[model samples]
Target: MKLNSAQLGKHLQGKLAAVYAVSGDDPLLCQEAADTIRSSARSQGFSERQVFHCDASFDWSLLYEAGASLSLFAEQRLIELRIPGGKPGDKGSSALIDYLARPAEDTLLLISLPKLDGSAQKTKWAKALIDNADAVFVQIWPVETAQLPHWISQRLAQTGLSASQDAVELIADRVEGNLLAAAQEIEKIKLLADGTPIDADYVLACVADSARFDVFGLIEACLNGDAVHALRMLDGLRGEGVEPLFLCAMLARELRLLSGLALQISQGTTPDRAFAAARPPVWDKRKPPLHKALQRHSAGRFNHFLLELQQVDAQVKGQAAGDPWSSLARLCLQLAGQRLLLEA
Candidate 1:
């Protein structure tokens, strides 16, 4: 059966499937699903599990060998095959097709992939897995601007602490919809709330740590149209081990927030009100830069920049070649300017 990350906890309650295939773009959610299956398999008396990584030169026979192997403890065995590249290409595809035709009974099989594309999802190998195993796809699309508040509420719920509705909305505005970043901030709230409900102050204190003296600061400087400071901040962030892609993701989030706010402005929402209505209030320090961004970038231009950042994000994740950090730096520089190339 197919299940989403949110549904896994309840779905795995009593079901014990022998074969599972989890594929997705969200690392945290995808890993959680895989971990759930592995944990369930262990509790179901699968005492031994062999793991294999599939690369360009991986042999089909290795899968068969693992399948044929028995547990020394006289229990059902589990075989976990991780294909980080997602699509296994022609040879691996053929091997998987053949294996699925008559899978092993004594050994439970689980297949994991980093993320699968639409074309790969329609392939015969993927189809066979869906037919024979419990297949799951975890898609992490960007959340809608209006729905961000509800998203923050649900995320905060995961940590057994709830934020006031206004507080949640405030936080959402502060961090926007970058789930990973939002998650990080929420975790901080859980740590500091000390059983009290999280509020706006709790969020501001922990939401923008990197902003203090790094790339975030640079981005803020750029937002405020201070090119010199932005450049310095970028260098500092790079020196501190924050990956180029990570900075790209954060900047993209900021730009996206600006775009959304700009849209609201076009509809006659005042800047002060926009900041107030933000799921999370914009940091007092960040306000200067963000205000400059609003002044500098038209809504359409900001949207273009945001899309470019998304593509940069994909490239940095190895979806495309070339130097990701260099590519990211160029994009940042362009955004720091008044406009950016729509395509890179």
Candidate 2:
């Protein structure tokens, strides 16, 4: 049966299901849920654990073989299958469906994956796992921006520490939506607090701004037409030693997604529908910025920028004689709505 993350703890109190499927984008919550299951399995005499990392080169037959094989070290075994990319092609789909039809005796199957979009949820294989009688499906969602401060306050209280309202807001602003960082910051505060409530001054003094600026965030800034913030974040990433080639590849990927979505929208598809139809589908939290970016440029304009990105790629690899950083800054400016000549 399907369950939310909060209900997972109580569900595990009774008899455990033979298969548990955990899917979500919140890394911290996902890991915690998986850990809870693992701990319960160990307590229930699941002594042997086998881990498989699924990727493009993964062998599907091994999964079948593992299920058929008996464990020599322990009576009960746990098999962990991690799919980093979240798309299990035809072979994987068939294998999963078959395994779920009749799971191995004395074995528990745990599948961890990224959050599946609506289209993925409707897939036959996904449906089999979620609808199966012998499986438990738990989906974890990220905390919204508006609720983060309260979440932080709750987490602090769990650690036997009280934080002032301003302190909670300060900590929340620094961590952004990264819960792992938020947890770590809470622990740091707990250690620094000496029988006193955490105040804004203490948070400012103890907690450094750990906000990470990823390529996706940079794209959002550019899409929102905040050239100064985008450039500042770019400089911050560069100062933190983020590779120019990686930055170029990330920007190019975003542009390509926008190009595809824009083409579909131009052909009379709604932005929401186009986003859902796009490959590696656009996430819901990111759709607003993506739609904004689409509005700022046409399909042809995005195509042109893709070509410019190629030159930046060549320059980064030393195939061309130009400063890649300068070119990247120019590309960032252009993406932020500045009309500039593509550097030669």
Candidate 3:
């Protein structure tokens, strides 16, 4: 069965499905949808949970193993498989199809992916999930710019506070359609304003610029080869208290993809063929900018990015010298085809 994000909460109030596939670009809503499922399951005696983050090297057999293993701690289990890359290659597709053929009893398998494009929706694994009688597919869409104020107003009501009309408009304008930032700002105002109704002045005092410079934006800047913009975004992200390890992890995902593409090219595969043959099959829209990035770095350079991420991880864990943020800046600069001469 298929449902929108709005229908998920009500649906969960009834019987829980054996499997769920949640896909969307709205991170906050997607996360909340997954959380709602877990919470509902927990209340009904699901005390055990396991999570898997799927990448190119992920072993699909684990899905079968996890399903077969009985959890001793609880009567039910919540198994979440997150595919940030979205495309579950041949093995993943087959595993999902086979597993969905007979979903385990007393286990809720939640598979989360980025928003599915037309072609992705037609894949065999996607069909297995969506076409199943016992599965629920929830598609979360982003809050459009025009709907921002109403969305903020709804969130405020849920947070046990109301906001003046001007205050809602000011926040909607400042956040520029970034739901995560808007959510954070609303939570902040809840603390500062207490039970008092929020106003335009209160919002202005409490929120920052609200133009989110998240890891995704930083990656786009690097891919587009805008070194200066990338640096500015890096600075903004760090100043906003984004963790160095989080940034490195995201950057590393991109670098690993690039490395695979570069390696294929070095083996005489045409860029077009390399992208098409890519494990997660590079979507057509991303191929252009990725092609640009591929030209800026070779297989060896992309391998070096893996090494740099290792160092950044160590720095974050306090197991190494030098600042992690500095290392991240250097990596970003190099990815954007610029070498930093001074301290990053």
Candidate 4:
């Protein structure tokens, strides 16, 4: 069974599953989902915990050992398997399928991974974890801009703090596409809330200008086909220590959006109608640059960029030979309609 973060809470109220798989494009939500499972496991007498980090050199048998081993201190335990790359390879795949096939009694297996693309979800190991009757998959997606304010409001309420619409809106603006920062801002404000409903003035006084050169801005620059601005923003983001994987991830999101809209436009759908039909329904203010973006690239080219991003991912992970930053700059330029004749 698959559930979102919202649904996971209510699901946890019932008996916990034998295996749980959680993945998302957003690290914050993924972490929260895993944490929730951990908490639920603990409350249900899973007092012992073991964590395994899967890497290129990881031994697959250790996972099997972890699953079958008897707990030393507690009768029930939680075993966590974290696959940052979201690939379990041949041996690990077999191990996962075998372990999940006969998951240990009195143990809860929690597998956390990076967001699995559609193709990844079809893999043997992935299907074993997901399609198994004893397993629950929690897939977390990023909060879109149009929904960020309400998300912020809900988050604020959790901290025993209330905020005016303008206040939450301001926080949303400062932390657009960055939920970690939004959560931090909310925590920071909790210390200062002091029994008063937050207003924009309070937010302005408490919040710092920390969102300079965020990925969303870089995306907007690319969508507008402003090569110079996009490159500069890329440089700024790199200078600010943003991971190339993160930059690539956000850029890939826009490319997906562009690819979908481009296909629609190519099939006789108006850009306006395509935007309206978008999964999240593009906001009016964000549609203009996307409209411009649609004019510059064909749907095929957008897909090509996404394919190249896979190489970028490999490079970032040191599995490929080249600088991902260089690749990203090339993508930025090309995304902005500036096709380069040579690789820099």
Candidate 2 lDDT score at position 283:
78
What is the C-alpha RMSD, rounded to one decimal, of candidate 2? Answer: 4.7
**Best prediction by TM-score:** 2
Candidate lDDT scores, in order, read 0.72, 0.90, 0.89, 0.89
My TM-score estimates for the predictions, one after another, are 0.59, 0.79, 0.65, 0.70
Q: Can you write out model 2's per-residue Cα lDDT over 1-344, one digit (the tens) per residue?
A: 99998899999999999999899999999999999999999999998999999998889898999999989999999999999899888999999999999999999999999999898999999999999999999998889989999999999989999888999999988887889999999998888788866899989998977887777778788988889878877887888899998988898888888899999999999998998898877778788778777888999989988898899889988899898888888888888888765443
> Between prediction 1 and prediction 2, which has the larger lDDT?
2
Weakest lDDT window of 10 consecutive positions for candidate 1: 133-142
* Decoy 2 TM-score against native: 0.79
Candidate 1, residues 48-78, lDDT tens digits: the string is 8789898888887898777666668756888
For candidate 1, what is the lDDT? Answer: 0.72
For each of the candidates, the C-alpha root-mean-square deviation to the true structure, in angstroms, is 13.3, 4.7, 8.8, 10.2
Model 4 Cα lDDT, one tens digit per residue, 34-135: 888998898999999989999989998898788778899999999888899999899999999998789889989899998897889999999988899999
The parts of candidate 3 lying over 4 Å away from their true place are 213-344
